[model samples]
Target: MPAVNSQPRRARSGNRRDEAARVAVLHAADDLLVEHGFGALTVEAIARRAGVAKQTIYRWWPSKVEILLDTLIEDTAKRLPVPTELPTASGIRAYLRDFADFLAADPAGKCLLTLLAEAQHDPGTAASFHERYLEPRRIAEIEMLTRATEAGEVSPVLGPEATMDALLGPIVYCALTGVAVPRDLVDTLAENILRPRA
Candidate 1:
């Protein structure tokens, strides 16, 4: 008889602990990434911050950029309360205000701004940033735009993609440049694109 492989037994035990460890590592990596810009960050630094072996971080994330990107997304999700219900213009404005406050309050925002700048220099990084970070937020904004459209709050003229871009562009542009993105701007952005009822 062929010998039975013990891999399954090892996998079951390894996976749970591995998942926990990865989460811990991410928590640590996020803090460090915020404290030090990506240019100054290293896998060893993340491991040291997280109190895990560097090998563990390597096992989970291939590169520092990948790790920082993932950490930023998770951190942003936790900090920002993205409304799941259909969004009103006021609701959208509120979220944007809260998001802007979150950025202004934390060093993470600067780190993210820097990462975005770096992405311009590195096409591969830009691709990953778009796919992993920007796409999901765009989808969520599109859903909100659709809701506004349905409620007759937004004009039915602009297509969804254009609507989303118009709504999001100013906030993102201001944030990237480290300027204040006012809540009023979100309203102005939506109104310009959506032309909501007077």
Candidate 2:
């Protein structure tokens, strides 16, 4: 691993406080990303916004994109609920509907679409994003779908992974296109892809 000496090491007594500062920086970055979009955000801007040294931000994250990706994952995508109990047929529909609403309501949603587009032009960003964020979300959604299948809420013939893609693809597509996603479409996606067979 590479050394991280960009910032002076905090005393052991202050490690917890340092972590709090780091979180503050992340929060500032998240706000800047939502406010200005990625094109205008920078380490200096984030440091100023967070009231931290530039070196502190750099010590933790190598690039602005990395920080933005971290912020997005921490704030948005990971928070999406995959029910612990097997979701009922209606519960599953409600979950998807709620998810759509959440996505449409935040700049984090726009940030994700921006990241996806950036990934197309920047392979390193794409790889990091897939590993750090998207892959985990995919796995979690699949796991939730599996629970639904076991509960007889979803057809056994449709695998969880495929169902997840089929269900989420439209939302992603709309997000990318800046289109409004109707709640009705979200429910239809749940019924068409997740409903159990007769």
Candidate 3:
């Protein structure tokens, strides 16, 4: 399957005024999320910060959750882009290291963790998160893994879905538990995942 566009939907008219407002709102939401966190962020505060009316924000998004969702999408795309230039094993390792660092320090990481927590209570949020962010990334990774398998770089014992769960589950578990990710874990995962099954 082709990679999905994970960006939030926006007006397609290409009008400069609408574009400017959208940029301002996204930036404001990002700044507020980093400064005050999700628990403290508010739509009113975002409007005030962006110098736009609350109606302006509501025009594009239903609530602050949607705004944060958009910000998270943008940030993750820029922060954890898939590595296309390296060999598959190397690329996976590099991606894991980047993910570890993102969980440790990036504001986007905090946003994602917050969203995960919130999704537990909000079914709408859960569905949107899965459809808009997680699924697309999974599809992209699976595509990469398929290429590696075809090229004979790695012989995965499990199918693509299970293999991905095995590779990414540990890091995500560490993030959820607030445990520090071990420095060598990336290499260990790469070795195990890329090794041919006996």
Give the winner by lDDT: 3
lDDT at 90, model 2: 71
Overall lDDT per candidate, in order of appearance: 0.73, 0.77, 0.82
Lowest lDDT sum, 10 consecutive residues, model 3, at 82-91
TM-score of each: 0.80, 0.84, 0.84
Residue 132 alpha-carbon offset, candidate 1, angstroms: 1.8
Task: Report the CA-based lDDT of candidate 3 relative to the real structure.
Answer: 0.82
lDDT (10s digit) by residue, model 1, range 114-162: 6678799999889988899878877877787788778876684579998
Q: How displaced is residue 197 in candidate 3, in Å?
A: 11
Tell me the spans in candidate 2 whose CA falls farther than 4 Å from its real position.
1-17, 77-79, 196-198
What is the lDDT, from 0 to 100, of the residue 29 in candidate 1? 68
Whole-structure CA lDDT of model 1: 0.73
lDDT of 3 by residue, 101-153 (tens): 88778888878888888899999999999998889989988888888778777
Query: Model 1, residue 183: displacement in angstroms?
Result: 6.1
> Which lDDT tens digits does candidate 2 get at residues 59-105?
77899888878778877645655666766667667767766766687
Tell me how far candidate 1 lies from the true structure as C-alpha RMSD in angstroms: 4.4
Q: Pick the winner on TM-score between candidates 1 and 2.
A: 2
* TM-score for candidate 3, residues paired by index: 0.84
